[model samples]
Target: MADPDGNVARAVKLETATISDALDRLGIVGQCYGIKGRDPDFRMAGRAFTMRCGPNSTPPGTVGDYIDDVPEGAVVVIDNHGRTDATIWGDILTEIAHRRRLAGTVIDGVSRDVHLCRTLGYPIFSLDHWMRTGKDRVQVEEMNCVVAIGGARVGPGDILVGDPDGVIVIPHEHEEAVLAAAEEIEAAEDSIRAAVRGGMRLDEARRQFKYHSLQTRKDAE
Candidate 1:
């Protein structure tokens, strides 16, 4: 679980299989805050490579520099302090990220290049979209630092799960435990679903499985 690379690969695989399931299992809460006209169905699953920026940071060597340094298959998470004046991601950055095989990006700011991202099918979750660059509004203060995305605290190596629904962060320290809990949750849900199909009442299914108590006791046994 401490191995960032392995955790990312596993997260990606799980995401590819079950985006909604993962979100349900992780108990994520955030709407899909993305620019219109882009890939609205964008979903990304990978380890987070966080960036925290403040006003007055330089360009071409600030956030972009750290972006270039992020390993392949990462999910770049940018916390621009909720700045909306300039765009943090754009067409060219999307291209580079795709080339690097990065999973996607989550920005607490604006992004650009809607058409290109749509065509490329790259996932980018952000506050807004714009044509202006983040030249004067933002600068990368730290790379791989803890940042907030949609009010969720995320750190480097944490699992980032994004989809049409929203984005969720699973802290690195709880990766394995969360995954295991998710699997158990899924299994119990499956049984409940089956019972429903077999003419069991919804409340009956919940009562039998003790669904409300499932998560609380997941780590106990």
Candidate 2:
């Protein structure tokens, strides 16, 4: 098993594409769908701190009021059942999350005040950006629990890597294997690129690196 902290550190150095390939090779489903970073330059990697939001109740529970409680460097992942009619994140949360040095925020729902997130260079990934607030429409029902984001299952402490491409979630129990596989995939792809740069034909380079099979599952091999 990889050291808990070390897995996060290592994952931070990898790209989601590589990690996604690794997950494929290991037969793990981690690639998220339809979620994207607010800014193309945004990138974030960290352990997840998940929250699940549901329809508001009487008096309407507060939304995103637990920002302060999230540990520094952890990604705040909110599962709002992919709601786009209302936003569960906004400027205030972006400001506080930036100041607190959170790794980033990921929402299965929409977010408002995207300008603040871009201005602060804070990473925010979501289904989309909308101005409608979720205050009366949604409320946090659980925290640090298993939640789904972009069709991927995310749980407390799961590794989340997000970039311009999107996000991928690695279960805590499989962090070590996932990280190792990602590293290998990345290295092989790097070599393939380098080979092509050094006068080798693309197909030959890919063949040499066995690029086509890099993401094939171990059991399949």
Q: How large is the C-alpha RMSD of every model relative to the true structure?
A: 4.3, 1.9
Q: Which candidate number would show the highest TM-score if scored against the true structure?
A: 2
Per-model TM-score, in order, reads 0.80, 0.96
Query: Which pairs of residues have clashing backbones in candidate 1?
Result: none
lDDT of each: 0.71, 0.91
| Tens digits of lDDT, candidate 1, 65-152 | 6657878878888988777878888888989998888888888888987888888888888887888987666677888788888677
Task: Count clashes in each candidate, considering only residues at least 3 apart in sequence or on different chains.
Answer: 0, 0
lDDT measured at residue 207 in model 1 versus the true structure, 0 to 100: 90
